[model samples]
Target: MSRTSTESVTPTPAVARRHRLPGKALLGLFLAGFVSILTECLPAGLLPEMSRTLDTSVSLTGQTVTLYALATALGAIPLARATNKMPRKHVLQLALGVVAVTNTLTALSDDYLLTLVIRFVAGLGTGLIWPLLGGYAARLAPAGRQGRAIAIALAGTPIGLALGIPVGTWLSGLGGWQLAFHASAVATIATMAWAMATLPNLPGRPAEARFTISQALVIPGLRTILFALAAYMVAHNILYTYITDFLSHAGMAGQTGWVLFAFGVTSVLSVLVVGTHIDRHLRKLAVGSTAVFAASVLVLALFTNAPVLVYVAVAAWGFAFGSSPSLFIGAAINATGDAADVAQSVTITVFSASIAVGGLTGGLLISGLGTASITWAALALLIAAAATVIGGRKHAFPRNS
Candidate 1:
């Protein structure tokens, strides 16, 4: 499990030069990343309204988030395998195209079941997008700048969550949930066009070794990081999936958009800070951020009445969670070397699965234990995630090459 045991795989000079298109390509990837997350999380902010419109319980509307995550979890590996031979740029375009079309259909659909099915389709595209984009970012980066490059690309998640989710929520308030989806469709289409114009043609390399789930499971570093990631994400989604509801319950209903906006703003700031240091301090960054995130959730759980405290907690949570994917993905790539794609795919699967479980469990908890219980539930999971990192400190993060 030591870093020394895993050999670092270097890219050929010719391949590196071919894939390197840092400026515009990185920006395009960032927007694509933002759109991907915005599409997945759009339902979170509009759950109550969507439930009323579809004549269903809020808990049932929440299942749409679960469904999308489950679909992405199930499809990530198979879809990655299927497209392993295609050019990376084409795969990205195709995935974004699916996002655009499915979201458009989502906006147009009036039936709950039809919307769920279309979201599931969008999930399939999202499944392909995450790992491919991560790998693509890694490929495009110039040597030591891989961590920052991936951070820039993956910054979309928080940016989307920070800006897109709140904006979507506000738009839904003005024009209904359908308007939110329509906007997502428009944004995704624009991202696709930018990607097409900017991204270099990145053909896949043939596998150097037979990469499989069983192999990934046996790698000690990979196993520990994935487990830690699952726990962290489960904690994150539990609170995230129901934040609007929690806000409403706290009598802060009118402030949901503004609160989420504040959260996103700090998130972007945190990613920028973490991006610079992740290559040198992967394990410390992982452990420290999760600890901050967990502490923030505890504050929310315990100090619900103080508005100032609540906003502080939200900003802390945003800053901590915002920097996580890049930290985790960078750790995974360091762990798996030549099998980075397999590692990335497995990480995405674990991530999506955790989101599915967390959202579903949060729904059940909300129905039975009430909305406030979710933060406590999330804090417990985050504690476990932190322990995983501390316990596997030596093995989970290898030395930067």
Candidate 2:
């Protein structure tokens, strides 16, 4: 949990007060965060190949994803609370190291249960380190630039989401599923090395800022927005959880690989475009793009049975969900002010919780109502997100909090 050298090697009290991160170092921080996210999701993209090797059915192979999500959801709060005082540099290194070691273990394991355990551990590492990394990114920025800095760091999430799956899929297709973890292990290791050499000491600690659960919970306008985000995410996760499954069942199996490829390509593009925009115009962007998300979901729900629309829906949904990281983090930062880290962790937890809920919701919706139900629920949630964004904007104040 070591911090960057800014705090540890200040020339004087005044200089210490003025210290900030270098440009390359800041970029390195964003890369580190992105790499960690990629490592966290590596197992998910390779689940099918992993299933064949683990001798388990794909449904059970899916447990690794659901449970990894659950673990991250449960682990976020305490990890944020406990590590607030730890050195920023050490925390990052530890997180990256956890990814590296567990990925190696996953690559080496033959047992499915053991592999599941490894994924859980890797998720835990993500929960423990990610909040701090996000908080520190904002802290590392100059006073007015927190929004821009956070947007850059958040871009990592999409980078991870977009790259990890494709890379894992390609590697697994070329060799075995194990190659995915090998690549993850190598990526995280390199990230760890770079983080050790870079990453600045964060200047603030949101967990300790007010030091009260109630206070953190009562962050300005947090409840409505958090729940809105959580709800949308849950719905999104449910739809996404069984995307490949549904496509296969719907006779789009032949195009599944292309769908994923298109989704990845579009996701990266959305992140690049929207992440920065969210930073500068939080309210406008949040309100404007929300319908885009809803429309994307609704269209997919109706047209998923069509080959062309199926591809379009997947790519569009990718764009919609891909823009979330920056918006959510920005909302939290706006709400929490000095408590940006804790707030960010809460968003992560909410996000992770949504994934877990999404899986359950998707499964039940698909089973009880039908696969089409998934889109309706997802669209409903996205509408809620839009409402929340609109509502928050209406009531928003200069509460730099």
Candidate 3:
């Protein structure tokens, strides 16, 4: 899985010569990425309503988020490996179908346990969708355009985070939290149909060897990125999973949607900035964004009562955190080269696990200590992540393109 091997496969000669770049297909992938993330993060906005309606504690309700992430983490590698030889279009369609069905079930279910079960099923779909989409985006990209293609495809995530969660929260306010899930199901169904109609048959290349998780771990650069990514995600999720609650506690309960919306907007802006330069300046972008993120968390921790400061902090947090997945995934792809799918699978697994860890940790902290404690704990992790990035600067971020 050397860089040469990876570069050679990114836009295989057959792929580049046989087909023009499929703009609509990439759009479908983008939508798939969008819907997948929307499904995963919808719970964050609805945690309070869910807790009350389900007759569960807030911490317990937060576990719904934890459950989804854990399921995704647990399932990502096996599913990625199992479907490695299949056509990506079919795999994507099936995964989106799973998302649609499970979310629909979640919308209709009244039982907390049942909803959790359905959410976990939806996680399986997301776990499959991410790596497949990453690889698919790379495959469809013209030679030397893989980074831009990935940036375009991954734009779905920030959109979902920026627009979807806040909008869902607003909709939940108008109707109920179930409305969010129902809306997600509808969106996912439409995206699945669009993908089915639009995505070209992307047959698996049998000549390309499949790389295992063990193989990916053996690469020091990939390992370092994964470690930093884990810490970063854990820190971010700790604050993120309970943001609505944090706002509510600060007497700004009615403003959660607007605050989150502001966060999302800056996130999109930051990701766009990263997209333009990520291919050439991966390490600098990663380290700088992370440093900004830590500083934002520190602001939130220290100034919990200042409305102006809070808004500014949230925007800063959104900008840095929103740009993260693309930069980190790009790092992984760069590290693994030809073994991009394996690297993606591992990245998703670590990402999911860290989300679960963060969510659970926040829940425990909120239950026992306090909400402000989450930011402090998160800040510590972010500092560690920054350290990892600086320490591994030379070896971890070699130019892949």
- The estimated TM-scores of all candidates read 0.91, 0.87, 0.89
Which scores greater on lDDT, model 1 or model 3?
Answer: 1
Q: Which is the leading candidate under TM-score? A: 1
Question: Candidate 2 on 68-98: residue-level lDDT in tens?
Answer: 7788888888887777777788777777788
Q: For candidate 2, report its TM-score.
A: 0.87
In candidate 1, how many clashes are counted? 1
Task: Encode model 3's per-residue lDDT on 96-152: one tens digit a residue.
Answer: 999999988887877789888988999998989888877788778765556656776
Q: Candidate 1's residue-wise lDDT over 66-120, tens digit each?
A: 7888888999999998888889999999999999999989888768898899989
Q: Which stretches of candidate 1 lie above 4 Å from their native place? A: 1-21, 52-55, 207-210, 399-401
| Winner on TM-score (2 vs 3) | 3
lDDT of model number 3:
0.82
| Minimal lDDT window, size 10, model 2 | 1-10
Q: Rank the candidate models, highest lDDT first.
A: 1, 3, 2
Local error of candidate 3 at residue 393 (angstroms): 2.5
